[model samples]
Target: MKEELLFVRHLHVEFQHGGQKEEAVRDVSFDVGCGEIVGVVGESGSGKSTVMCAVLDVLPQDADVSYEQLWIRGGKSSAAMVFQDPSAYLNPTIKVGRQLIETILLHPEPVTEKATQQQKKNSRKRAWEHAEKLLEMTGIRNPEEIMKRYPFELSGGQQQRIVLAIALACRPSLLIADEPTTALDVTVQRQILDRLKRIAEETHTSVLLVSHDLGVVAALAKRILVMKDGEIIETGTAEEIFHEAKEQYTRELVEAARKHGSRSQDKRRISETILFQAEHLSFQYTKFHFLKKKSTEAVQDVSFFLRKGESYGLVGESGSGKTTLARMMTGIIEPSAGQILYLKERWKSLQKGRSKAQCQKIQMVFQNCAQALDPKRTIGEALTEPLEIRGGGMQDVWKTEAAETLFKVGLESEILEKYPGELSGGQRQRIGIARALMLKPELLVLDEPVSALDVTVQEQILQLLERLQREQELTYFFISHDLNVVRRICDRIGVLYNGRLVESGDAEQLYREPWHPYTKELMLSTLTADPKKMRRRRNVPELTSRGGTGSGEENGCPYADRCGYVMECCKKERPELYRFEDREVACFLYSEQHSGKRSKEYRMASQI
Candidate 1:
């Protein structure tokens, strides 16, 4: 057997919190061989990230770190890390290119031979070139344009790619990616993972990928480490983890991942009465150049309806027009070419004129709670804004209601007096939820509401939402990339791809039998906690080039490029919605000619 690129033997990490010793990492041991991808899987507070931080010597000064043995490549070890939150890790004020170039220059290789000095200089130049290539490889459209931009100017996905590019600039033998793709959309995530895999293969670099996502780990990692509460509970290959897990926690994690793609519910009749409808919903943004002009169609010809007391979910990868559609639903951005009808009353008509009561009927909770609330304002003020805007004059009564709402979200009333900055991410999210509840809206649009939360907090929020829906008879339009949360809360789900609804059906039915390829891929990509089951699953195939049209162009099947069962008509003619038992799928595989002929092919592909 080849020598491992890196090894960790009996590592222990701790911290002194309030003068008491707290073990963050306990007797953890792992190895990353040359060109190997080792994944660390765990929920929040599992100390997975803490182990990586300890290895990098990036932990806080007060952190206590001990290790029996630590070794790396070439009999000398140096490593670099890419953090989970790019916004917190990257310098917001500096140009990304400059920062990357500076990082490369700062890490000069030890020159031995006289001729090696010139070789090292050449390596530095190659490193800079590789940095630009890395950005492009990671799916950033224009590398030069992105490099010129600062970290804050880029989107979350773009920032993550930039950080990844910088981490690779040093040409380190071992790289640590800490939940690097957690904030990315599914498509972007697929692209990013593919790039990392390719880089690792080409450079023979080892990777320690820490993530809560099981699907990501399955796709990229060969060996798996399952952590719970700062301890390694299980270790195995991907197939063993996914298929034959022995631990109860491992089984629960597998079940969660398996459940993500399934929607099992007791048969509940869905009424035909549509409470809210969006007709020809279209939105666009203008792009101004010196002399050229461009208009980006974010949401085009999108139409959907929400029934009273029904939970509807919108699912899609990043930039697939999920958030844009959510914004239109909440009246934050008016549709450029469509009408939003609330019980036969158009939003345009309401915009021209409407009562406060009518306006208060719709409310939204955004993805980022920290940015949603005013930093200077206390939580009390933030929660009461909607009430004040609607002229709900009973301030004292609403204040009491606000406290109750906070309490419902597992928060104390004392949190009301605290500023947004003073609250934790989870607390701020609850405050956002509290503010939305205060409006007493008939339809609540939750846009990726629980994506930023940890699993435990997410469970609490899910239960809270379910309870509120039952008690208040609230209709929800829940938007999320997390299929597990969607399965747990949504009654019906609408799968969107590049601004079009490719699939929609009862959540349970859809999960059990996902007809659309995109939907299936999304389900397959989600990770579970089980070590044995995860190991049993095969590696996800790399996304193939979809050589047909631009993203915004109208298509029969938006996923035709990535779909494994593509036909001739899939390229030229777009597939229309075809009924599949209880769901609707837009794919030629379900079309007339290939429907029966493709059944075998579909079964074979489904095994993936």
Candidate 2:
């Protein structure tokens, strides 16, 4: 039999919150073998992450935890954890490379062979070497350059990879990855899973991956444990759990996954009236030093139009200019170049320069409602801020308007009285939507609106957006990395890469028949809920995604370096947006300049 790495039986955890004892985890039991990948799958607050924390012994001091038979081949020191939110875990002031190397020195593994005092003194050099190796192992291409940049300078996906490198620096025997790929894009997500599998196999490390993503859990885990309301409901092999789940909750999760397989069939009736038009839209930011300032384009000569009643998706990995583009559209910032035409008028980009009517025409629902809403203010005050600050109509009507908005967002009138801190994640998000609706805007720019939400909550918000769009005749510039969410709501989709548009077309057609190599990779990276579709034998070759957020500054195809069918011509100059069937793709295979084989590989990549 395979060597048993960890065996935990009857684990329990209770936390103190608001003078109340609440059970966070209850009677959870599971085991992992040497070089095993065991997944704990559940929705948010199901205690999937809490149970893993119990095993790792990283819970807060005030919490209560108990275990009947907790045995690890190696103790707590042998395990390292990667958190869900990279931003929250990493130091904002420190550079990523330095932090990674520091972690290695801080947690040095025991030397098997006895070394001299002089050899021990050379650990700094050895630590740097290990840090570089870990960085490369986690799919960072330009490690030397990336290492110099601070954590805030990097994108969410880049920070996540750096965090992973730091976790693996100690070379722990057991790695507990909790929602490791939650902030990552599809390509980076694939690379992370591949790298983890390799490390587990080559180094004999065991992994306990906890995630709310069923597709991700199915892709990696050999054995599966299902959790609900802090209790382990079912345990089985990947195939068994996905295909033959016995419990009702387990079946519901499996069904959610299976339902996620097909394309979203919702169709919208978009009008010909161009509600929002972005012409030659470009934006750039300057990096400051004492004397020298360098300008880098966050968004470049890109343009798209959103109809009066359409939900348009802006899809890309982190730092692909999705947020920057959304902010520009909402007049949060002025573009250095190009113009925004709203309702056939030249709309001002600067917020202060724009009229109150222009402001009322466009409103945004921010990504993190917790940060967006004022903590001290009640939800009613939060909703009224838009009307109060703008001096819309009269002060007496503000409360009435807030009430109507709350109901419009599908919340009870009582919700307006509570502060944002008192509400749940989903409820806070609804309040955010209500606040946006209070402005009664014709266009809404939603930046990763449903990303931070749980899957069930995400679906509910999507449905709410759908109903609101139809009822209010609202247009949306929906920015998100989740292709499934985009597919469900977006009438059209544009693939953004390195501050530019790579492809633009109908959502369904682009997903089904992608022309650009990067688009193909993004689709390939999207994980579905089926376990049988994933690699089980574990001999799959390591396919590294070189650039997570962008292609390098070389005057060639940004993705050419990582493209499987890269040709010599692809290295010379960047490809322009070429016309493909009802879409624009920045690739040469379809153009007259193309010569080599492309279909078989492209077709295989398109198989959802």
Candidate 3:
């Protein structure tokens, strides 16, 4: 039998909101075995995070908590936590090295006493070295250089890695990770999970992971606890919870997660006519350093065409310029080095001036639905405001159109009266879609539209988009990091790496057997609900830096540093997208010159 690292019994927590008592957790009982990785999963507001907070005794003062027994064998300092957003916990003004060293100084492994100035100096040097080693363990390259950089200088994945390093600085016996990889890309998420698993095994630390993603939970946790409506609805091994759950809620959650991003079997035959095209589109941001100017390319020489009523998806990590490309397509920004053709009409810059018809034809839906909406304005106003701005419709006519649009998006007329803050996340997202549809757009640029939504709600939104596209003949330029979501919705998909289109092809084909190293890494890193299929992922090496940009040299292949089958030529020159079977991959391995020298890695990837 395994030893108990953490014990809790009858854990209950309540919060006083507007003088009303609201229960967040009720009668929760679970224990973490020594060195075991456990997971607790549920939808938002289902009490998973609340229970974790209660156990850590980090709830707000307004929260009232009661429990029969709650204990951590190694005491308070023996455990640490990593939150969803690392920026919230990190000090933006301080350097990474100073911050990490400060954490080490605070939580001394031997519980040392105060010392003289000379002793402090010696301890400081040792702490700095230890901090560098910790950062190295988290798969960060040039830990010394990263130590000098501020938190804002790092990408989302890099920031999360630093946060994890700090959490491990205390040498904690128990580590609580709450949504640590929720907002990361598939490759980065896999790296983080791999690091956690390795650490747990090496140090015999217990992990309490909480997330809404069943795939993520299944990937890391050996034992799983399903939470719903402030209760532990089910508990079992990862396989049992995923495949043989007794509770209807657990089964529903699993089904919803599996259904959200599954590839669609129905291949809709759309028109061959092109609706929009980007010809070598590139955008550069120029910054002035004293008197000298430095230019950074955000999007570089990317060319793709979208057919009428067809969805084209772009997948990339956080800084791979997906959003920038979307903004250019929607006319929010202009290309610095290329042309944009809409309906075969070449445009220089939309910001300079564009026809009202042009503006009305291409509408965009952002990821954050709540922020896309006006909080002070009623939903009715938001919907009609678009028509009102156009100045061609009467008030009554606008209201009627708004009502019909709501119905089309599966909402009711009653929702028009409520403000954005009053509605749920799913409802707000639906409202965002309705607002975009009010303009009767021909093309919709959806930027991570369903990323922030729950699994079931995401499926609903995806279905609604499909239905609307078929009915209205709307063309979509969808951008997201979720490969599965992209596969489900997009007819063709493009993979971006460091501002370049590394691969593009049929969505299902790429997902089935990606040719590009980056694309293959993305497909392999994506966590699935099936535990058996996910087990091998834990052993995959850290192929790229969690920061999205790997340690490749300038003017060469962006992924050469991380590609397992990289050739000497890859670092000397950049490879353009070459035709490979039915897809375009920017790798010499698929090119005629290197085709005869295909590595075992390429063969293995092809077989997958």
Best prediction by lDDT: 3
Candidate 2 per-residue lDDT over residues 1-608, each given as its tens digit: 98888898999999998889999988887788988999998888898887887887878998999889987776888788988888998898988877988899888867747877787778877887888888888777778888889999887667888888888887788889999888577767776787777778877788999888888898889899989999999999999998888999888877765554455565667899998898888998998888899988888788888888998999998877999988888788998999999988988866549888788889998889999988999888888888887874876688888888888888999987889988988999999889998888999899888877766677788778988988888999999887877887888899998888988899888888887777877887877787777664232233434343134446777677667777666777777776645577777665556744556335322321
lDDT of 3 by residue, 1-608 (tens): 98999999999999999999999889999999999999998888889888888888889999999999999997867889999999999999999999999999998656357677888888899999999999988888789999999999998889999999999998999999999997788888988998998888998989999898888898989999988889998899999998999999888888878875577665566898989999999999899999999988999999999999899999999988999998888788889988889889986556778777788989999899898888999999999998988888689999999999999999999998999999988899999889999999999999899887777778889989988988899999999999988998899999998899999999887888788878888888888887878986545566545323243556668787778887788877788888645578788876657666566455323522
Q: After superposition, how far is residue 583 of candidate 1 from its true place, in Å?
A: 4.3
Q: Which stretches of candidate 3 lie over 4 Å from their true place?
A: 111-114, 266-269, 543-553, 580-582, 596-608
Tens-digit lDDT string for candidate 1 (86-111): 89978888888888878776765565
Please give the lDDT score for candidate 2.
0.82
- The global Cα lDDT (0 to 1) of model 3 is 0.87
Candidate 1 versus truth, CA RMSD in Å, comes to 5.2
The Cα error of candidate 1 at residue 427, in Å, is 3.6
Candidate 2: regions farther than 4 A off: 94-98, 106-117, 142-149, 258-261, 394-396, 536-554, 592-608
The TM-score of candidate 1 is: 0.80
Q: What is the lDDT of residue 435 in candidate 1?
A: 88
Query: Could you tell me every candidate's TM-score relative to the true structure?
Result: 0.80, 0.91, 0.94
Sorted on lDDT, best first, the list reads: 3, 2, 1
